[model samples]
Target chain A: MTKTKKDVKLQQPKNQKYAGKAMTKGRYIRSQMKRNWVGYVMVAPFLIMFIAFTVVPVVLSILLSFTSFNMLQVPEWKGLDNYVQLFLADDLFITAFSNTMLFAITTGPASFILAFIVAWFINELSPRLRAFVTLIFYAPSISGTAYLVWGIFFKGDIYGYVNGWLLKMGMISEPIVFFKDVNYIVPLCIVVAIWTSLGTTFLSNIAGLQGVDRSLYEAGAIDGVKNRWQEAWYITLPSMRSILLFGAVLAITGAFGFGAIVDNLCGNPSTDYVAWTLQHHLVEYMGTRFEYGYASAIAVVLFAIMMGANALVQKFLSKVGE
Target chain B: MAVKKLRVRGHRVVLNRSKGGDVGITVMLILLGALMFLPMWYLLIESVKPLGERNITPPLLYVMKPTAQNFIDLFSNINSTWVPISRYFFNTIIISVAATFGCLVFGSLTAYALSKIKFPGRVAMFKMIQWSLMISSTITGITNFFIFIWLDWLNTYWISIIPVWASTLGLYLMKQFIDANISDEMIEAARIDGAGELRIYWQIVMPLVKPAWLTLLVTTFQQVWNAGASGYVWSEQLKTFNSAIATISGVSAGAASAGSVVMMSVPIIIFIINQSKIVETMASSGMKD
Candidate 1:
């Protein structure tokens, strides 16, 4: 994420060569610092709070993952016992792990591609039409507990919308217990997850579509870009790669951390832990069992998976426009 | 419409042979939109439907008869004698508003310094911020809860509002917007006119980045609002309306829809009103060519 700024830094040496008398790097940095005291002052508020809440907690969580703490007493260092227990002993954690991976694999790319395609299609509309369509796609994400309404739609009994309609059409004599049955649980949760996945990433992609320079299309046309598909591949996709990559990062993180939607749509710890995610596992230990160290270990595992996925995406995205 | 063509650099290429293609795309968009909208639409209708119709065989798409009875029952049916729905509403409103306000102000402040100022360690600080994004909040969830407990703020509203002030995404967006639009020359120009940094930020940068801040406002508001009852608030009266709604929704189908309606109305309304502006601001949110 931070490497995006490297290109700008690369250009500075060209400007530095034009100076008649070049100062030492140390002196130049000191001069820059002297003039930018207000800059530090400006950032202090958020920086202070960020360090306290985010930075400190991350360190503490990593440390806590190595120890056993129940919050009432001092933490006892347990080394790899928490991790061993998480992997080998806890059956629920294994269920949550597989479920989370299943979710991430299925929903992550699905939503990422869906969001981009929808954004691209919406970009082709007239401005007013574009805004309206964007809102329609975005509405699902912002509507809190709206997926719970899907619970009504997929309710296990005849009262459910899907079952009622299917039953009326004579498609099925019995109502499918979508959330309760293990067979339907993952699939149903995936559908609702995709619906709500058009979130911040979708918004950013729309912004990215809008941010594309109009001149690039003109240039592409002159370069023999023969069709819309060609134009998108050669011009639009490359231009918006940063936002595309940003969306991918968020999507990967969101997919791995897919708990809220499942928790809301299906029951928490879903039926027989069919839809339980690593996040649900972490919460089970953190919030319910109060096994802080074990929970931290679960979190650390989740975090490691996310970082790996992020690295993979970064590598893939760096190849964009190549 | 408009010949269904792309006019690129005076090279007008008709992308579609017939008007049917446009209609087909439009129809597809509408279908997808309806799919996206079905749950919310159902929520609105179901919330008002009579309780009998809610669980009836072959559920009605459009309510034959609508009543506010469910909404009435939602508030009236709470078993708890002490905590009213209104108190949950109050707690969420105060927490979300305060937290949103703080996040915007502090986030933008940090972003301004990082984006516009050539301060030492600015890059390092931003890199740190970016690194934080890789770690999910769940990793820190226990630690935060423990911190709140140690501070003796477990049940207090401050636990909900305070720790959330440092918004990484907000800072990123603001920095991107400020870098693209708010130039150092503008700040220097203001400084030459005897304007202080604080005055310059308030007077100059604030107006320029109103669109970006508004975008941040919607996102941060939605996050905080959805975070109701899920966070550190344990007290009955201190619980957020969303958490309350979560429990209430489990009561019955009608009550669940009502809870959905109640939980969603504010953010949805806010999004509707600010939708266009948010879209416009997004054009400035990322790096410029």
Candidate 2:
């Protein structure tokens, strides 16, 4: 029995070593596979969605732009005709381009300046008061309810709230046709845009301003920076540069995406000063005429424009950082 | 001693003079706030006014005699045979809630993986998410619309809810919170106890990311609520509350205007009640980053 037990013990170590080496190799392969498998599993939904919804659609739209396809019939190949027509023939396209430029120029800087000033003011307030006032300013932007009420306030008729008030105050003898008039369309929209835009950037800027180190302000004060304005210039503005740039990008993107307000306020595209905006044309083609090919061309142009704008902004921002 | 006392008094006067400057600042801010609130307030007050009384000169700042008729009219008009107002509300509620919930869940999960897991190409994935922000959903809307057409999803709920599920903003924000608040030790401990990564995320990490989850919830809710385009395309059975109001009010000349007023004001009224909380949360969280 002793001899047999010794033999068993000696064989056991050799067998154990063999098993251990094999198991280690298996475990390594399994873990490596598991790691990649899990990673891919976690990201699968996003990839599927991004491809099906985003990447696929973008490619299809580009293809559709080259074809003359209405919803009723299959798409037929049409070379650069749509593009040529848009550039040379479409009167409304030029109007839209100019109008979009005007919108970008005006609303971009205007909203930024307003949000900055508001943020600066809120920064000076006590914490609780600052929170309260910030909420009040942001309320307009987030609430769909605000837009509902705005629609009523700017109603074009004499009985419309603004017209009635103006007439009653003897500011104007007759009710101003704010919505119908071509002259007032862009300006009125800009004002409305500014009102809605106050919340997002205001909150962001205020948050950015708070990140400015307190010691910087103390140092400036020691150097005879007698007031908040001087402290803001020397300390707050420099510290909040990134936030400012982020806000500007957001503003630019928002200006380009100005469709809902314009559609709601102005009943038809023809009456709109900026009727040639990609959104307007695409909606018109889709809804009324069903000119899918032409609409796709318009969309492609707009997409290119948006991408170009984004690149330019990115370049400008990077330059600012440098 | 007398000369020193006079100089001290003069310094006090100079300091006191700036007290007026503070008042000027206060007045200026108050005016700006008023300007911001004016249009919204005007809309609400006018919505409550009787149609005949709407044209009052200098406008009625306060409703002299408020009526429930507008609300009553809106309800009755919606119930009419021409438009399915109740169905539209249901559709909106479903889409918005589903989309918001999906964003929170999916965003949190992806964020957890990005934050906790150390793997190859992780940084590349993070950058991809950031770059996605530059690609506006508006630019993709047309393409998405066509893709849905191919998928036979037109006039379906999936059209609205699916596209919004992969929100890069929500993912970015969630990742930020996880980085700030959550610790790697917690995950290691969970793993040591034989808890799976999914279990760790569900049982431990989720609770810690509540603030970010809530913020994303509110923002997503707001976005979905104001959504006109997606629903306009996807669900033929669906008519948004706003669209219904616009259509009804735009078509009907006289009695329908009051109904339109109610429909329009309902969303705003809901907003005013929750505005304080929403704004405060947004402001605080916004400052944190």
Give the alpha carbon lDDT tens digit for every residue of B21-127 in model 1: 55776787778888888877887898899966766778888988889888877777665536887887788889999999998999888887787777999999988
**Fnat of each prediction, in sequence:** 0.62, 0.32
> Where does candidate 2 stray beyond 4 Å?
A1-37, A71-74, A116-120, A123-131, A143-145, A148-155, A165-173, A199-246, A270-276, A316-322, B1-25, B78-89, B176-211, B228-289
lDDT of 2 by residue, A185-299 (tens): 7888888888888754565576456545555665555455566666666667767665665566567767776766777676666364543455666677766787777887877
Q: Write down the C-alpha DockQ for each prediction.
A: 0.42, 0.27
Q: What is the TM-score of chain A alone in each candidate?
A: 0.90, 0.75
Cα-based lDDT for every prediction: 0.79, 0.66
TM-score of chain B of 1: 0.83
**TM-score of model 1's chain A, to 2 decimals?**
0.90
Q: How would you encode candidate 1's per-residue C-alpha lDDT over A33-81 as one tens digit per residue?
A: 8778889888888888887788888889989999999988999999999
